[model samples]
Target chain A: MSAIAIGLTGVTKSYGDKVVVDRLSFTVASGECFGLLGPNGVGKSTIARMVLGMASADAGNITVLGEPVPGRARLARMRIGVVPQFDNLDLEFTVRENLLVFGRYFGMSAHQIEAVTPSLLEFARLENKTNARVAELSGGMKRRLTIARALINDPQLLVMDEPTTGLDPHARHLIWERLRSLLARGKTILLTTHFMEEAERLCDRLCVLEQGRKIAEGRPHTLIDEQIGCQVIEIYGGNPHELGALIRPYAQRIDVSGETLFCYAPDPERVRGQLRGHTGLRFLQRPPNLEDVFLRLTGREMKD
Target chain B: MWGRYAAALPANAWNWIAVWRRNYLAWRKVALASVLGNAAEPMSSLFGLGLGLGAMLGRVDGTSYIAFLAAGMVATSAMISATFETIHAAFARMHHQRTWEAVLCTQLTLGDILLGEVAWAASKAFLAGAAITIVAAILGYAAWPSILYALPAIALTGLTFASLAMVVAALSPSYDYFVFYQTLVLTPMLFLSGAVFPVTQLPDAFQQVGRFLPLAHSIDLIRPAMLGRPAGSVGLHIGVICMYAVLPFFLSAALFRRRLMR
Candidate 1:
């Protein structure tokens, strides 16, 4: 087994009376892609901060890259790269200058930064925009540049917080492609995202977080099969309460949400057969995925 | 609590220098425009008030009135330049640009970033103070080599003001909040500190309050040097300015630790 890149034991954090992270414990092995899935204000960002030693944990210990956090965190940070949620690229500098300045933050010499600039730009697919100002770049281009800047230190582990949020589908696809390349290169990655599809596509193993606690932890497909089932039959436009009752006997589990009845079953044909004769019932049948598992574990409530 | 943060700063100078270098590089892009902009207001005030008002007031302290006002302008320029840099420019980096957040993700600590920012603002203050001194020297209103003595005094004055304004930057939530600091604190301090005229000319009550102002001590040190006179209470003046510089730095650092780290 590979060594652990990140490890936490009974970590807890609270602000005033509100406990942000409560007894959270997990580990990501070296060269593996690990995802932290949670809704807003569930303390995903707070966990990222604690692991980086940017914030202190009220209880328990955190180790990253074999160094104790909030103690030797500075030394650990030297071998780690981070892509924060928001774009904080130096708006004053050009594309090359942004990378150059970021490298200096890690104490890398200008000569060393310049030597890697050409390849780094190519990695982000920003070769043509080398001299362009960051403000002039598109949203996707800025996000890519942020990723490239994080790699300036040649770090062993990459910690990214929602690295692809707010991007269009095409842009998101490109980011995922770049991330896959990094994983192939044997770099450990810790990613946080609200997008379950992103977690499913990229993360080798992942954990679901709710109210500062780990609710589920496993491979995406395994969690889907174990926690949910083989298929989900969505029925809309009919009375959700009556339809939920009618399909309950055939489904492994049934959930009614705002004029829609979600029926989870091992076989889609069984649930579909029960809904066929129902008048004015709109239905969609697809294989059970991570979102079903995620929503089932964390619920579909809107969160801040 | 303050000692913990003070000890957190790296013993090596290179990290803070890197932070300084980042700001220098960004400032270099607009060096000409920025330098000219800082020089304009003080230069105009020096010419407008010094030449115009000096004609009516004449000499009060055994030198020409314009010569006296020139020294005060140097101190005032340093104060305004450093204050603006910290409150406006540094506030933008902390709040709007989120530059400090990016830097914190690296190996550098919050103490390192704060030192770098304070150093950079002090550098800007030095330039602004030096520009006015040079102009005053060129115009023959300031002593030849004696004004050289005022250069270090101007730098200390810069450090003092920059350190003080950083506290305001830490407390402020927006650009609009800075106005309260400027109007209520900086403006009154300017008038009371004898930048425009002699402190003795004011009422006894105002003079007592002026004794506590950092700018007053700065002017006391700088005015004598610029006039080519033997300055009195040299150790006391330096001590006061140093106190202002050191104490506020710790205060601001503590405030920023609460603001950013949480």
Candidate 2:
């Protein structure tokens, strides 16, 4: 394996009495997209903050780009770019000015920033909105500009926190495409998101975190195959308990919710055959996804 | 706790210049309007109190009330400008705009941001003070070349108030919280600091209180220079201003680092 771009060992962080990040350990290899997937209040952003040295870990060590965090974080940050979850763009400046100013924060000169800004704007498809104020731009445009701003210093590691959370499908796809290009260019990425599909699409390897603990870690597909199965059979309506009992014989695992029974099996046809005579129940069988793995590990409960 | 805070402060002082430049670039967009807005208050106070009140009150000490008030206005304007910038504007950048958060993600530390903000606020206050000083000079209320000597005093006043206000900004949860500081602290400081009236005329208790207030020392240094008179205990006034400027700066930097790094 290539050298680790980011390494966290038994890292723990807490706010007062509540532990935000438990003793978690993970590594992101160089030139790969790594995802930290979890639900809200599961300490995804907190972990990202620790890596960036915005917040200190209560215990354990974090090394980014081979430098100890919180101590040499400023040196590490010079090679790392960050896109926070919210739009913290300088609304006081125009789109281009924001990039220029952000570059200066990294100690980049005006000439250096100017040389790369045009190409970056082109990459983000924001060439036309160069003179537009941040508030004047659409939600997608602001997000794109923020991404472009992050790249202004030509950072080796890109740390993004839910880059596409509030974006529309079109905007999300654009960001995803841009991220793929960055990956192709060998930029190491550390991404955090609750969106399972985003992880499945982008991450070469991922870890599922639940309430500050890492429950599972592996490639997306491998995690799904191990935690869940190759296929999921979701049977809706009509006596969930009875249906669960019927499907239990053929399925590897079974889960019961309010009106639905989810049966995970290596072979969908075997589960389908078992439910052949169940005319009163509505059933759907499809390939198990990361969502199924997430649901299985984290449970299907809403988090505020 | 002090050791941790000391560690959190920036090792390099020059790093704050970038943050100062960032603010300057943003302000450059509305340069004219911002300058005019900053100047209007002290300008109006100069005319209103210096002329209208001057007509009724006549001379203060050895100099005319307009001349005395002009010098005091220089310090008061710096205080007001710095207070508003650090309290309201810094609060917005820190919380609403999240500009400081973005800056913090880079190589700059919280200390850099704090110093940069204080520097920027002081710069704005200096401009406001200089403008009113020029107006006072044109109105014949200031001694021509001697009044220019008050620039350093005005700058120090700016730093003192900006640093003091930053402590408040670090603690403030919302915009409304500033009202308490403005009314309870700033309003009292303005009146007691001999900005609008003579400090000696105040009661012995208020006079004793004024001695500790930064603005009182600021006006004492500036009032004499603007009137072409000998400044009394110049070193003492400058030392007091320096203490206010330096101590609150470290205090506020520590406060901001604690607030931000958590």
The candidate that wins on lDDT is 1
For model 2, the DockQ equals: 0.62
**lDDT by residue (tens digit), candidate 1, B45-160:** 98899889989998867888888888888999999999999998888888979998999889888778878888898899999999999888888888889888899999999999
Residue B174 lDDT (model 1): 82
Highest DockQ: give the candidate number.
Answer: 2
Q: Residues A1-304, candidate 2: write the lDDT tens digits.
A: 3389999999998899999899999999999999999988899999999998888888999999998888888888888889999989998789989998898888888999999999999999999998988889989989899889888888899999999999999999999999999999999999999999999999999999998999999999899778765677788867877777776777777877668878877777888888787787787888889988888787762211
Native RMSD of candidate 1 (Å): 2.5
lDDT of each: 0.88, 0.88
Q: List the candidates' TM-scores in order.
A: 0.96, 0.96
Enumerate the candidates' DockQ scores in order: 0.58, 0.62
lDDT of 1 at B241: 96
For candidate 1, write residues A185-251 as lDDT tens digits: 9999999999999999999999899999999998998998898866788888888777777777777
Residue-level lDDT tens digits of model 2 in B216-254:
999998988888888889999999999999999898887
